[model samples]
Target: MAQAADAEGTVVVTTTAEGGRAGARALATAVRDQLPADRPGVVAVGAESGGGAVIVIAVNTAARTAGQDASTLVKHLLHGRGGGSPELAQGGGLPTGQLADTLAAVPGMFTAG
Candidate 1:
């Protein structure tokens, strides 16, 4: 897995799996549960597989206080490609090799949004 953490408490993680969507989902969930909760921020996680790619965005309580909604922001960023609740969202079928670039852009997402 590749992970990046920002000063704002946002984290972006990427991984590759042989199982595709299922594997991506599992990893995203695991990472979300492992993130620190001292501050609110976005957890932007992704996984790429033979079939396609998966992106999941999760948020903590502090993020809410900052008016940051990971799900909504992700959907907007991906042009309405994903689906999820206010706190969590998932999108996939991105072009192969796009996960890394996308994850790298996540840090700027909060401030830009």
Candidate 2:
């Protein structure tokens, strides 16, 4: 798993999984569920699929307070198509190699957005 704190002090947690969409979403949900309720956080889980990868994200209430939208983040940063509520989102058709790098860059992207 990878963890970083965004400019707003929202913890961003990310990880990779072997399974596809279902697996990534499951892992993301697991990680998001583990975060303390009082803390602001985001969880991202990526998994390889076909020749690319899919990313799943979950945002907590505290994180949403800053107007964090997982769907928008993935679509903008990864150039992939996806949609979900501000609290949960998933996107796919991204370069598999870029998964980690993109996840790592998430915190910094928050500032730019």
Candidate 3:
């Protein structure tokens, strides 16, 4: 069975069923769905600089993210793209490399919205 991790915007399930892309696509969709857009004042707040790709999570535009600098965290959570802020965060890239490490980290992070 492909095991999908339970990160806020991801689902990491172990499986060679479809060469992995299937699960990865599922994760992207989940991320887009979970991103909060109609939450009223519950805005994300922040800023990031540089010329890397970005993954924007529609939450707020704050100055910091989960724990790291908005920009850095954005790079860390790529899904083919990357970007961030306290109110809004973005991440995207090949879910390979540190993908396992990222998925492993999901358990320690906040799960339910």
Candidate 4:
């Protein structure tokens, strides 16, 4: 797994997998504990499959408090690539490394200054 903090104070966490159910809540909890109390963020866990990759995302506290609807935000980020609720969402068919970049960029949408 890898983590990064952006200039807008959005925290991002990412993990890559070959094939398996990457628990969304577990990762979210772990990542949340490491995040700043005032930051909004997302954890994207991905798996390689067939000809593409699948990315699952979990939205964090900052986003909920910022009036950013997690589900909506994720859908926008995935761009019709996948679907899920605010607490857990998934998308597929992205290039190998695209999902990580997607997760890293999501926080800016909610925390942009």
Strongest candidate by TM-score: 2
- For model 1, how does the per-residue alpha-carbon lDDT over 43-83 read when each residue is reduced to its tens digit? 66677655566777777666767677767877876778887
lDDT of 3 by residue, 5-67 (tens): 434543222222121333333443344344443321111111222322222333222212334
TM-score on alpha carbons, each prediction: 0.76, 0.86, 0.28, 0.65
Q: What's the C-alpha lDDT at position 48 in model 3? A: 23
Q: Residues 1-113, candidate 2: write the lDDT tens digits.
A: 66656556778887888789889888888888888777788888889988898888898887788777888877776675887878889888789888888777777865654
Query: Can you tell me which runs of candidate 2 are displaced by over 4 Å?
Result: 4-7
TM-score of candidate 2 versus the correct structure, residues matched by position: 0.86
- The reply for model 3, stretches above 4 Å from the true place, is 1-27, 30-82, 85-88, 92-95, 111-113
Q: Each prediction's Cα lDDT score?
A: 0.68, 0.80, 0.35, 0.63
17 in model 1: Cα distance from truth in Å? Answer: 5.0
Residue 30 displacement in candidate 2 (angstroms)? 0.9
Please rank every candidate by lDDT, starting with the best. Answer: 2, 1, 4, 3
Question: Of 2 and 4, which scores higher on TM-score?
Answer: 2
Task: Quote the RMSD, in angstroms, for model 2.
Answer: 2.0
Local distance difference test, candidate 3: 0.35
| Residue lDDT tens for model 4, 26-98 | 5555665666767776666666666766666766767567654546655677775567776567776777667
- Give the distance in Å from residue 32's predicted Cα in candidate 1 to where it truly belongs: 2.0
